[model samples]
Target: MLTRKQHELLTFIQTRLESSGISPSFEEMKEALDLKSKSGVHRLISALEERGFIRRLANRARALEVIREPDTASPRTAPRGPAPVKPVAPAPATLREPANDVIEIPLHGRIAAGAPIEAMEGATMLPVPAALLGPGEHYALEVSGDSMIDAGILDGDMALIRRTDVARDGEIVVALVRGEEATLKYLRREKGMVRLDPANAAYDPQFYTPGEVQVQGKLAGLLRRYH
Candidate 1:
């Protein structure tokens, strides 16, 4: 038997995975459950996992799989309201088995590897090996400068970025500053300020308030073409 919130979350996840091949983010789950914060969603997810209802995919951001659905007929499921709707059957195995193939992801224009620059949006698409990506939405950015050369991210290399709004400290991320300019740098938090660190010693780190810096994605892999 599962709690009402648990059942609702599982159903929502299953529905999303069936329609779109990716799992919902923690923010989406929090909003769907009408919860106060993402912590609440974390607790619910942990509970579900402990009961063998779901499994988190390893090495993948925001990835989840519904291992088994709760028994809907149990008296403890709803207790008062109408019986819970049975979850739709899991998607076919063939639909979820292309993790090792090639796929095209949106290729957003160049991102700054030196100074902050506008990350232009366009209709370009980048063909990427699926093995380079994990279980989340992804996009590509063309590197434009040498600030990240020390990180082995050279000029003109294709940066494979996984689309996500949250990242941990010291991780290389694409950060949007003041909702306008975007740059690729290491993310750090210090004294209530967000720090964007460069991999090269020639440049200084940039700092902004927490609200000014928005995480767009993290570096998943790099694609370089030899001349």
Candidate 2:
């Protein structure tokens, strides 16, 4: 059950939304709850939000909204979690969960060479979506050479690729060819063959027939960490 204070706060929010067709301000919530400051109301609201009762939107002041009514019935019967166990215990033997501390990277589908990037479905990659990388869904690749040193990509660096099937003929990409191989190269279409040009002049440009070269993904961003 809501210890009376929570109930009062929720009721005030519900009422304001019903009356104004919009959410109430934090100050209003404090006034209704007789809180000395808005921070007290803010904490309670955060608690309510945690419990699935509301959500806070970004950048708007009148930002509170009730998502679900609080379940205030039955006085919270689940016995409060065994009192925080005494001391450290050995890990159970059969419970060897491989630590996937490596957050599954979110991956967009691969792009094809010489074509506009297309939406990829059924190809989901797990990634920490919080990385402020550039546009489009993200994928990763092993950097091959240092030609892009001017572009900051180094060999052995993990490039976060974005899915795109088409480009302006000079974008770096992951190209798959009839050789059943994938490589990072600049895509260029000249005459009849699509040219897979390496950024490093030491490596020569590879050519392909009309249907020989396919782009799997384009270079969007890179991640490198020392071993």
Candidate 3:
């Protein structure tokens, strides 16, 4: 029998996997369980693993495999081996692959690294590898400036954006300024202001009140075409 907290955590993990087809990150699980720290989530996951309820793969972030669901009638048995490790998308230049599991995302036109451009929505779909994208809803944006050049993002590059409204400090984000303008920049939240810092030093950082800034999406991967 599972404890109340364990049951809740397992249910959350199973639900996320069914809905998004990916394991929830530690931060995500922590938030869902209303825990103060990821350590609490880690402990619960460890307990579940030892009880043959879940399997955690080594050397991978968010590499969790839910072997069985709570309230199921099957007997609890330990996983035979480690989970397969797959290459994940990092916040840098991406490598090309032959063919893999592809998912389609909406191409939302271009975003500005130099000047803030109007975000446009279209009916086109962009195919990207599922392994690189992980899970959750995603979209693509064509970059159109040089302010983020130092961050391996250049003009004409296609940025794979995981749809999100919340971003941690130092994360590259699509921030909507004053509810109208949107720009791609490194996000930092001060006591009362939201700072959008450019990767290149030539440009100055822009700041606004917290209420004036809204995060649209976060950088997940980048697609560049070599001429």
- Give the candidate number with the greatest TM-score: 3
List, in order, the clash count of every candidate structure.
Answer: 0, 18, 0
User: After aligning candidate 1 to the native by TM-score, how far in Å is the CA of 201 from where it should be?
Assistant: 0.6
Clash count, candidate 2: 18
lDDT of each: 0.80, 0.57, 0.74
Runs in model 3 with CA error above 4 Å? 1-66, 69-99
**Per-model TM-score on C-alpha atoms:** 0.59, 0.44, 0.60
Error of 1 at 222 (Å): 0.9
* TM-score between model 1 and native: 0.59
Model 3 error, position 28 (Å): 29
Model 2 stretches astray by more than 4 angstroms: 1-103, 106-129, 146-150
Mind giving the per-residue lDDT tens digits that candidate 3 earns over 160-219?
Answer: 898899989999999888777778999998778888999999999998999988899999
Model 1 C-alpha lDDT versus the unseen true structure:
0.80
lDDT of 2 by residue, 66-165 (tens): 6655443423343652112122222122312122112234444433322323323344544432222332445665555465554566766766776676
lDDT, candidate 1, residue 148? 94
* TM-score quality measure for candidate 3: 0.60
Rank the candidate models, highest lDDT first.
1, 3, 2
Q: Residue pairs in steric clash, candidate 3? A: none
Clashes of 3: 0
